[model samples]
Target: MPNAIQDQEIAMLRSELEMLMKEREALLRVAGYAAGFIAELDSFDVPRGAMQAAELLAECVNGLTEETLQDALSAVQAHSVA
Candidate 1:
């Protein structure tokens, strides 16, 4: 029984790790896209501070969940379009 419980726990942890990896990739993709956009801009302007936000976002991936990451991605997309 103890071994079964341990196995279940290991499986749950593995799932969480996989989710974290996916989240990290998504956040990194966001960062890369933001960086590419920044690179194409003619010059730094008032909104140039968005680069810093992207950097922070890249580092915040591990702590976020699927729903939260989705909401964040939507917000980022909206903001970028504006």
Candidate 2:
């Protein structure tokens, strides 16, 4: 019957749509990771001492506590050392 055929067609379309949605989600995740990697690559060129100083200033202006500043400085130092 025509109705049976139409129902089958709708079901197939729904399946394909679901597949497309999943693929899109995967693509977005990969894009996000790639962007972060690119940002790290860009950060690599910055001088360590300058980066630490800039980070300290930002933390001060942003009203971060001394402890938070120290933590951030440690992370920057670790990255620079690596």
Candidate 3:
């Protein structure tokens, strides 16, 4: 009975891990697109009122690790073609 309970717990944990992974991928895709869009924005064109918000977004994206940023950018590029 104890072994069975442990097995059930492990299964639940695995399921949760899988769900988290999928959610991470979705988040990475969004981050990638946002980074790309921000890159194309001209500072002059951004409204003064929105400058702070835009800076915050850029700062958040820049805060990602290089590997994570690469993964995020790749995620969007991969789906863009289809």
For candidate 2, report its TM-score.
0.51
Per-prediction TM-score to the true structure, in the order listed = 0.54, 0.51, 0.92
Estimate candidate 3's alpha-carbon lDDT, on a 0 to 1 scale.
0.95
Once superposed on the true structure, which residue ranges of model 2 sit more than 4 Å away at CA? 42-82
Candidate 1: list runs displaced more than 4 Å: 44-82
Clash count for candidate 2 is 0
- Per-model CA lDDT versus the true structure: 0.65, 0.58, 0.95
lDDT (10s digit) by residue, model 1, range 29-50: 5744544554465545626677
Worst window of 10 by summed lDDT in candidate 1: 37-46
Residue 78's C-alpha lDDT in candidate 1?
Answer: 63
The best-first sequence of candidates by lDDT reads 3, 1, 2
CA RMSD of each candidate after superposition: 9.4, 12.7, 1.1
Q: Could you tell which candidate, 1 or 2, scores higher by lDDT?
A: 1
Q: List clash counts for every candidate, in order.
A: 0, 0, 0
List of clashing residue pairs for candidate 1: none
